[model samples]
Target: PSSGNKAERFGTASVAVLVRHKPGRAYISPDHPIAQEGAGVVLTCSAKPPGWPVPQYRWFREIETGDIKSSVL
Candidate 1:
């Protein structure tokens, strides 16, 4: 209407989006009952709703003192 033209409509445009998320859970392959020392084990972890910034994973082991000790797996 400001460019020497008539107005066309009385409405505007709208846009929207929605995303759904599921429960996240970690999974371990070859879930063996017992693993020996110096044994090669494959540890796998993942999560749901991995959006925007990616998720980081950290592995830990429980020691005799009942304390969690971080480790690389």
Candidate 2:
């Protein structure tokens, strides 16, 4: 729905947000210094303070040309 649509009858709602929980560094599993050519790879990415509202993972690989290819999940 567009913001222009009125919801006056809906009244107001209270919300609370906490941002004090500092997140720990992220880590990757099955880290390979150099991956084999044409080999299927499966890597798991995770971060500390794991809970609901999980963080999205973006996989990136650097080709020989020093160019990064990224895929979003």
Candidate 3:
């Protein structure tokens, strides 16, 4: 009740984003290797979504000839 102007006829609506469980393939914790190279490993990235928006883990490192590095966690 406060459109004191003279023109107000804009409309737009859309909603249909249903994504249930999507993160279920990211593991690199103490799953195996006991580590013994530099003696400084604490890698832990897990994922197994079964509900809402709760999945955010960015950690990559594939150097040698692949090129894909971004780690600051």
Best by TM-score: 2
lDDT of 3 at 13: 97
Report the C-alpha lDDT of model 1 over 1-73, residue by residue, as the tens digit: 3788776768788887655555366455556646679996676666554543455777778989998777754
Listed in order, each prediction's TM-score against the native is 0.46, 0.49, 0.29
Worst 10 residues of 1 by lDDT: 46-55
Identify the runs in model 3 with alpha carbons over 4 angstroms from their true place.
1-10, 15-30, 50-73
lDDT score, candidate 1, position 60: 79
Q: What is the lDDT of residue 59 in candidate 2?
A: 72
C-alpha local distance difference test of each model? 0.64, 0.69, 0.72
Q: Candidate 2, residues 1-73: lDDT per residue as tens digits?
A: 6878765565678898855554467888867645689987677888788544567777776879998766533
RMSD of 2: 11.0
Q: In candidate 1, which residue ranges exceed 4 Å CA deviation?
A: 1-23, 30-34, 70-73
